[model samples]
Structure formats: structure tokens, C-alpha cells
Target chain A: MADVKDVDWDAVMADSRFQSLRRKKTIFLWVLMVFSMTYYFVLPLGAAYFPHVFQIKIWGVLNVGLLFALSQFVVAWAVAFCYERRASGQFDVLAKEIVVAFHQQEPRR
Target chain B: MRASRAWSSVILCVISVLVALMPNVALADATVIGGEWRALTLTVFAAVIGLTIYVTYRSASHVKSAADFYAASGSISGLQNGWAIAGDYLSAASFLGIAGLIALNGYDGFMYSVGFLVAYVTVLLVIAEPCRNIGQYTLADILAYRNDPKLSRIFGALSVITVSTFYLTAQMVGGGVLVKTLIGIDYEVSVIAVGVLMLGYVIFGGMVATTWVQIIKATLLVIASIVLVMLVWVPYGFSLPDFMADVVGDPKVQARVAALLGDSSTVMTPSELGQRFLEPGLLYKMPVDQISLAMALVFGTAGLPHILMRFFTVHDAQQARKSVLWAMAIIGGFYVLTLILGFGAAHLVGPAAISAVDAGGNMAAPLLAQYLGGGRDSFWGNFMLAFVSAVAFATIVAVVAGLVLAAASAMAHDLYVGVLRAGRQVSSGQQVAAARVATLIVGAMAILIGIAAKGQNVAVLVGLAFAVAASANFPCILLTLYWRRANTAGMVAGMVVGTLVAVGLTLVSPNLTYPLQKIAAANKVLDAEQAKRTAIEAVLQNPWPQSESLIVKARAEQVALDKAIRLAQADIKKYEGQSRSFMGLKEPLISLKNPGVISIPAGFLAAILASLWIRDERARAKWSELYVRQNTGMGISKSVSH
Candidate 1:
């Protein structure tokens, strides 16, 4: 509800640290994407092709597909945890900075 | 020479060691598989069709303007709209899939119930108002906004096609499976019938007819589900918890429960699987599958092209929000009934009844009612299951129609009219004609996919679609709502990546290997034996020695595999006591034959990344404020034409 156009885009972009951090964030994201897909999509394929390739004997009762699918649960929890704190926080800030900058620029226009 | 080749002995020992573990063996039992009831079935189906058509025309009279045709205008009351949302949301996943999962998986089937319920929290909190507030026609209005109509058109078209194809696939499969088994209509014809019927609903009355049909069906289904649940629990005395505890405590039930809890080792041979549930595993404790299913539930509802489009029919964001909340209540109640249905199948009929009713455990609930109410031969009982099955068929048919309508709307309204024609004003007759023709075309498209996926598990494929929708659309739609930093580049990136990963996952996943029913029938005796041997060998070895010539194993190698299995089961148990848990969790698998639960958040992760990627400076500045402000001031319907 606040006037987002009144925030300072010039001051926000002037900060060089956001630029350095953005580059690191991009690299980290690509790495995250690869690992997530491997477990969620790729490993499931491997498990199907050879069901026994990845069996843990104590888990001998559980099939590889079940294990793989279940990891999604763990990953999801970890991901959600990370997101609520790290990703959500960063995005919220990023969002705030941009919205405020737009608010600031509007009065000048 | 014998001494020099000693290295071969070691190598052979290692190979044999690995080879011994390769095959899983389990016991065998006989199962009586049943078909959908025909004579009693068609009468019920005919009745539903008659009802839907009568309601269709009755509702059509309400639509008199372009606004009326496209949005169903403002005639739909909140209760009607909410019921319609329930009708739309049920899809294959809620109706056929969850029921089937319970039939097969036992208590864990409730995971879907939970996933669906919890996701609405996200929906109510994150999506409902924003979607109602931000855009119209499709997700495109929100995502593309004032920048590019072309972009909106592209994304809208893609979203519609993906959702429609997947939705249509499930409906057609449900129809074909029912028809082939029911009145013995060919599967292809069943699919065609569904496609045409759906197109007719959308083409004749557009959203108005579709909305009323959904409301009517949702009402019937919810009422039926409640009645069925109450009936199941009442016979065991009026005490619900006691009945459940009694069911849980039974040894036969407990064994199935153990198998369910056991996780990986519990793949049932065709025989052991009959009317039995495998145990639960560590997977249960972690709630991973709950996550995957939950992601599907949360993201799937939000991103559904048809469901999202339905909100446009409402006048304001508040109405849309109210509609969603009411729909959630309806959905929650329907799912609770399903929990009764699943446990009832497990509790009352045992695994035997479901194994008799349908090859997949999905039929457990219907079978539970059929068996409990009395066998199919009982005059009233004959129609109970037949009624459920017929409604199941209609449910699929309704869903497929909604999907085709959504796709058709995209092709006609956004693509043909909005994009190609631009500022040119087409006549109302022409617009109506184009929409009908597009419906026909999309209808044809649905029929084709449905036929292609004919014999496959309709529910699993629907889950696959949930994965794709969660991956591709949810991120773009949700992030654009709250995250002002989100830009066009980021939105585009997320949609593309999410879709690619989802489709890729589906291609590689176990779905392809598992749905072998449609292929030319192999000697099920040998296949069943292998399934039996695999279920057996999974545990240890054959407890039953060479038996009489009744059940035959085809290959000679199977005999050797059986011996090795006996050796391993003996060796493993002798070495490790039965008292221990693995990694402080229950065993990971209860049954290999039936996959009951999957953690579904990978799809959401795709969404999260895609949402976070927008980097363009200028676009980010303008777009951020637009999300919260636009709908608060402009109203939802105003953006529909724009």
C-alpha cells in the first residue's frame, strides 16, 4: 500500500556490493539446479534402469525408487528452511530496494 | 592349470555375490481381478449425461454478453462458484488417483489428503488475492503485464497447451479404461467420446455451462463420498476410533502394515500382494513423499490454466479469494471422506477385495463399498460400485472438457483474436464461431493424447503433470505477485527451466516401466511368477520347495535365481538381527510393486529458482509496484479485455 515510487533506485544501484554478490548468487544457483535435478529427475531414471544399483541392505526392504523419491522430502525440507531464511530474506530485500527505488523516482517524474 | 585359474574363482565368487542380490523374491498368492460393471453402469452414466446436459442448457440462458460467454459474467453465486472450483480441482489426482493410492498403499494414501489441504494455506496466503488482483484470461495477464502482449500470448498458449494435454491425458485414460472394461467399448472410442462431450460443453455454453456442470458434479461427489464413509464406519459400531483401532490391530492388517512400514524389502510377489498392504518405512518418518505430493497440490492448483482462468469469471479479487477458501473447505471434506474410503478398503475388505476389483489398488474404495454394502450380485450393491464407477467416468469426462475449454480459450481468445487480429474488431458471431472451432481442434488434440496414453496409470501421469506445472508455472506466477525485483527475463527463465526438468523427470522415472498393462499380454503366469519370484527373492528365497505343476516359472534361470534368494535371506537374517532399524529410521520400502508416496518438492524448487532470476534493472523498477496496486484499484474483470 505504501508509495514504492518514492524509494531510492539511484542510491540502491550505487552500492557496488550488490553487484559482487549477484555474480556469486548466479553461480550458486546453477550448481543448485544441477544437483536438484539429478536427484529429482536423473537419479530416478538410473534407479529404474537398474533397480538394484543403489540399494542399501538395511534399506533392503525399501526399493531404490522409493529412496530417491523420499530424498525429495528431505531436500524439500532443507530447501524450504533455506528459502524461508536465506532466499526469502534476500528476495524480500531485493524486492524492497527495487520497489522503494521506483517510489522515489515517481515524484521526480 | 586349475591352480593358475584360481583368480577366476575369486572373480566368479564376487560376480555370484553381486548376482545373488540382483533378484528380489517374495511369496505368491492368487488374485481375482474384476472389470467395471457394464449393464448396471451405462444406465447410471446415461443418467449423469442427461443431468449434465439439462443443467448445461439451463445455465446457458444466463450468458447473454461477451462478458457472459467468456467470464460466465457475474451470475455464479459464491456457493456455486466455490463448488465449481471444487469440481475443477478434483481432476484425476483427487478423485481416481488418491482413491487408487489408498487402495494400494493403506494409511499413507492420506499423504495426498494432507498435501492438498496444506497447500491451500500457501494458496490462501500467497496466491488467491494476487491472482484475482493482478491479471486475466490466463496467467499471462499477470506475468507479461503492460510490457508485451506477445509474451503474454506465448506464455498463455504454452501454459494452456501443457495443462490441457496433461489433464486431457488423465481424463481420456480414465474414460478408456472404464469403457474398455465396462460396456466393452474400444479404448479409442472411449477417448473420442470424452473429447467430443467435453468440447460440446465448452462450445455450447462456454464458461457458464462448464461452471454449472462442475458445481453439480462436485455436489454429487462430495455427498456420495460422505455417505460412503459414514456407511463404512457405522457397521463396525458408531465408534470411529475403536473401529480404526480394531482394523489396525488385526494380524492380517498388521502384516500388511508391517510390509508397508518395512519399505524396500517388501516388494510383493503377485500372490503375496493380493488383498495385502506392504509395510511403512523410514520414508514414512521423514515425510518426504508428503512434500512432493504437497508441492504438486500447492503449485498444481495455483498454476492450473483452467483453475486460474475461472477466477476471471468473478467480479473482484475478494470474490475470487472467497471462492478459493470455500473450495478448499469442500476439497478438504471430500479428501477426509477418501481417507475413510482407503482405510475402509484396508480394514474391512482386506487386500483381497481390491485385488479382485481392479489390477491397481486404486479401486479399493469402490470395492470397499461394493463388498461391504454386499457383493456385486446384491441388488442394491450392484449399483453402488457401478454408480461410483460411472461417476468416475463422468468425473474424467468433465475434467477433460474443462481442459479442452481452457486450451481452446487460449487458442481462440488470446492467440487468434488478441494476437493475430490485434485492433481489428471481429463480429460477435465470428468470435463465437472461432471459439467453437478452436474447442473442436483442442478437443481433437485431447482425444489423441488420451488414446496414446490409454493403458498407462492415469493418476501417475497426472502427478507428472503436477510436477511439470509446479516446476514451470507456479514460480513465475507467485514470485511476480510478491517479488518486485522479478523481471521478464527471470520469469521466462523459470518457466522454461521448470518445464524442461519436469518433462525430463517424467521421461526417466519409473512410470514408463510400471504401466505394462496395455502392452500385448505376456504370459502373466510367467510374468506373475517373475513378479512373485522378484517379490520373494527380495526377502530371501523360496520357502516353498518345488511344488506341483500348478503355478509355473517359465525360465530355467529362475530356478537358479530362486536358490540364490534362499541362501541370501538365510545369510542376512542370520548375520543381522530383526530387532534393529536402519539409520535410525524404519526400512525404506514396504512394497516395490506399488509405489504409494513420492516427495514432490523438486518441482517447487524449479519454481523458486526461476522466480529469483530476474536481473534487468529498468523492468524490475516498473513491475514491482504493479503487483499489489493494480488489482486493488482496477478490478479483475477490467483487465480481462485489456
Candidate 2:
């Protein structure tokens, strides 16, 4: 546990780095969340609303609907990969720095 | 007392297994159930039981503390946790049910699998990290952090218990039917055995045992599915087009399908039939219900108490994120295989044989496994069938263990410790004891419900559970983390109203029974007529002492009854059409089979409006603390080191 009591909450809250990390993460996650949600809804929506369009044969047995549904697995994997990259690379580093700063200043208080 | 109860249940499981193995036991009428494969299937089942007993014993010694019991001492790594998550998440519903659905209803079943996989994206991006950072043991911990602990714990415990119990019942019922059909065990015995095993896991081993059970089950399930897929693919030269073409051109498949459609006279060309099967409208005719079900799955997965509770088992936010990523890969890959499994069953097992065994097509996967191993008479065929059945049975037991543990945690940690004790400090031993006792109660309730729901469609219950989770649980958890203005009243209103509306809509909706009730009524009458015919035919077989006139009259009556029975069966098929609603109504009160589309938004809106409508200063005051901790992972407990 990070010794929540000794660290100064008001100061940490005002830290510019902490503020930036939160903003960046919030925007990145929401955008990803929104995009994934929209991309997913398209499968059910297209299959239901435009049956003829989705029925267009793309291959011997594969139709547009089947292909679209299969593509979702790829898309979900891609989204997870992207989020993992960003989270591990950028978000965790920034959050770790904030944690370090608070802990380093705790003894001086 | 609790220990004795647990022992008795285990004894019951042993007795039932013994009885099921006895020679010349009364078998079900279904040809699929028991024949020559009983030894192999029971051996496989015994192996799984042996594994559970060993794992639970090992975990029991380590489960001395509350943390050990609840979060497996936070020792599970990302990879193992990922597999466990897959095991817990992929119920027999996904493995057996969806594959069967795909085999029976082509494109629509694949659509369901898509939503299931894509739902993980929501979990990864939103729920995983924050939940791990802010919560401990139960989901209620997260809420209690920023709101009134008592109020939040109470509601949280209530929703968790409700969702988990609803989900547990579905698994228990599915387990019962699946076991009975595959091995010819009685449904009551199957339900009791499953309940006993699940209770043994949760009561003795807690999360650690549950996690390992899930991990082992998941590995077995995935490997079995891959092997099945490969076996299926080999016959078609590993070519997709070849498989599709064969599936379409196979005369047996077409005839069986025609029979299933109840229109053998009107035969479409193979290509046209292929087009119809490959298209999207076979099972789900309603676009609205599709959208509703899709929404529920994508949102509801994030809110499942069992899934969410997994995060607490990991050490930190980063591990939690990694676990979800791992889960996504395994689950996504598994779902892709389901397409082949489904289509393969349709091609190999034939729809006629599949439905002849179980109407819901639940037997498609297992039967397909048998066929790919060379048909029912072959040794390899029965061995492969028993393997898949055992893996599926393990799948159900693992999932139910997770659910029972989650509910017990809510009952013990959230309700008893947090609310009843008013957040007083409880000894670790006492907490563990409470959880064990809670497991017994919950397991008993599930067993009774599973037995009572025998032969009834519990698929609706699964849908209802998802809708409730999405509507009631998701909105509150999401708002608590994001919305600074979210207050206790708003959260309360959201849960109460969300649960009410979702459940209310489902009760009135076509999901309860529209055509199903009407068809079931017709079936009852048809069954009686068929039974009467069978009796007369039996009497006619021994007519040496009877008069010729009587024998001739009985033969004539049997012939007439056959025609009457066929007509009655066709009458039942007529009610299969979805255009007609329940209770003689032209349309259902709510046409959407899943209530997510309406109820999910209602939950969010209620929370938002209630928050905006009412003010709570204390909640707003604590937002900064929660915000920092959630984002930075500060104050999160380390892995318990005992």
C-alpha cells in the first residue's frame, strides 16, 4: 500500500503532471471506448437493416455479414493491442512518476 | 455444521455417480443419452472430480485469511488469471450453447459470438484498471470508498447476490441438462452432483481453488475445441469453400433440414438453401432484438460481479490490464473456432440427428465430436464424445464456482462485515467462516432452483441476468468512478429502478413465452396421443390369446393415431412462428427479447438525473481523493504475504 496518510493530497491534486496524466488517459480511453462501441454496433445494425447489402457474396460461402462478424475479432484484438501499448508505454510511466514524487516528498513533511 | 453439510453434499455426489454407473439403469428415451459409452464418460467425469478434490485440498491450507479466501492472496499472474477469466467467462453457454446455435442457426449464431468477444474490449478499456486500483475483495468496496460505506455496501451486496444467483441458476440448469443428455444420468442427480462439486470448490478452496479450476477447465475446453475444429477441417481438405460447398450439397443435411423446417415437399435448390443458411435471418428475425441483445452483451460483461471480482485477485492495475488483454486473446480465438464447430456439426452430425437428441441443438458439439471420431459405433467416437462432454461439464462447474464465491463474498464481506457490523473490524478467521457458511446457503438454493427448472428453457434467465447487470450494476459502477456529482440516492435509484425495469420488461416481454407456451401446450397433447398409440401397439404384439377382431381393430387404431400424431406435431410447428405473440396478443408488450436497449439507457439517465436533481456535498468533496487514487494506483493493497 502507498501510505495514503502521509502524502499531501491537495498538493498531489494540483500537480501539473498528475493533471496531464488524468486528462490524457480519460480522453484516450473514452475515444477508444466510443470507437469500439460504434464499430461493434455496425455489425448488428447493418445485418438487420440492410440484409441485401450484407448478403452480397464476397467469396464462395462467405457473405458480407459473415466477413463483417469475423472482422470484429480482429478489430477487438487491435483495440486491446493499442490500449495495452499506450497504457504500458505512456500512462503507467506518467502515473509512476507522480507516485514517486509524492513518496519522495513525504519524509520532508 | 457447515463442514458436515459440505461433506454430505460430497457424499451425495459420490452416491449419484455410483448410481449413474450401475448397469441396466432406466435410461431416457433419447437415443443420444446412454448406450455403450457410459464407462468412458464416467471415467472422464471421475478424473475431473479427482482434480477438483486435489486442488481444493491444496487451496484450503492456504485459505486461512480473508484475503487468501477472497483474492487468492493476490498471487495469480496475468497469464494464469487470463485463462481463469476465460474459464469463468466462457460458460457452457458459450462453448456448448453457442456452438450448437451456430450449427443449428448459421449466421445468427456467429453474430452472438461476435458480441461476446467484442464485449471484452469494453472491459479492458474501462473497467479493469480502475476497478483493481479502487476496490478490494468485493465490488462494493469501490463504491464504499467514495459514498456512504453502509449504503453502498448494502446495494452492492444486493446486486451482486442477485446477479450471481441468477447466473448460477442458469449454469446449474445447463449443467444438469447437459450431463443428463450426454451421460444418461438423471437430471436431479446431475444437478445435485454439479451443486455439490461447485460448493466443495468455493467452501473449501475459495478464490484460489476456483481460479485454478477455471484455468484448468479453460485450457481443456480450448484444446478440445481446437482439436474438434481440426478434425472437422481435415475432411474438407482444410478448405473453407470446400466445407461450405459440402455442407450445402450434402443430401442428408438438406433432407434433415427440410424435415426440421416441416416442409419436405417444397425443396429449394442446394445453392438457395445454402444462401439462406449462410444469411442472418434464420433464428433472430428481429433487428431490434438483435440490437438489444448486442447492447446488453457489450455493456453487461463489464458489470458481471464474477468478472469484476477477478481484478481484485491480481496485484496491481497493470497486472489487471494484462489479464484482460490475455482474456481477450483466448476468448476471441475460442469464439472464432465456434463458427467451424457449429458449421461442422451441421455438416457432420446433421440437424435431424442433433435436434432429435436435444431440441435446442445443445448436443451438436458433442455429437459432432463423436462423428468426427468415426460415428457412434466406433471406440474413438465414444472416447471423443466423452472427452468433450467432460470438458463441458468442467466448464459449468468452474463457472458456477466463481459465481458462488462472488455471491458469498458479497454476503460475507459486503453485507455482514461492512453493513451488519457497521464497518467494524472482524477477525480474518471469522470472515472466512462467514463466507463458507454463505457458500452453503447459496449452493443449496442453486441446487433446488436447478432441479425445479428441469426441462424448461433457462436461456431467458441468462439474458435477464445480463440485462440486469448492464442496467442495474453497470450504470452505478461507471458513474461512481467518473461522475463527481454522483450521489448515494442517484446510485440507489439507478439500481432499484434499473433492476425493476429490466426484470419487469422481461417478464412482460416475449421472452417469458409467446409462441413457446403455445407450442408447449400442443406438444403436451401430442405426447399423450403418441403414448396411447405406443401402449396399443405393445398390446397388439402379444395377440396370441386375443381375438382376431380385437387385434385388427387395435392395428387400425394404431394407424389412425400415427396420422393424428403427425398432424398434431405439425400443429406444434405452426406456433413456432414469431409473428404471433404470447397470450393471444398480436404483439408482445415489449418485442425485444433482451431489455438492454431500453433499460441500460434508463439506468444511466436515472443516475444522471437523480444526481443533477439532488445534491450531496460529501460525495463531491471526496472526488479528488478517489480520482487520484484510481488513476495513480496509490493506496491499493499489495499482494497478501501472510
Task: Give the best candidate by lDDT.
Answer: 2
Fnat of each candidate: 0.00, 0.77
**Clash count of each predicted structure:** 55, 0
Place model 1 in a CAPRI quality band: incorrect
Which digits, one per residue and each the tens of the lDDT, describe model 2 over residues B1-642?
455356556756675665545464434645453576677767777776677677776676677789988998888999989999999989999889898898887888899899988989988987889999888899889888788788899998999999998898889988888887887777887788788878888888889999999998999899999999999898778888778777766644555444333333233554565566777877887889999999999999999999999999999999999999999999999999998899889887877568768878899999998888888888888888888888888898899999988999999899888888874778889999998998898889999999888867678889989999999899999999888899888888889888988988887787665676667656776868856666676768884746644454455455545655766687577766664553455546766788999999999999889888988776787888888888888777643443
Evaluated on chain B only, what are the TM-scores of all the candidate structures, in order? Answer: 0.75, 0.88
Q: Which ranges of candidate 1 are over 4 A from the true structure?
A: A1-109, B1-40, B61-66, B250-279, B282-290, B457-459, B514-625, B628-637, B640-642
* Candidate 2 segments whose C-alpha is farther than 4 A from its true place: A107-109, B1-21, B24-26, B31-34, B252-268, B514-587, B638-642
Give me the overall lDDT of model 1. Answer: 0.58
Two-chain DockQ for each candidate model: 0.04, 0.71
Candidate 2 docking band: medium
Native contacts retained by model 1, as a fraction?
0.00
Scored by DockQ, the top model is 2
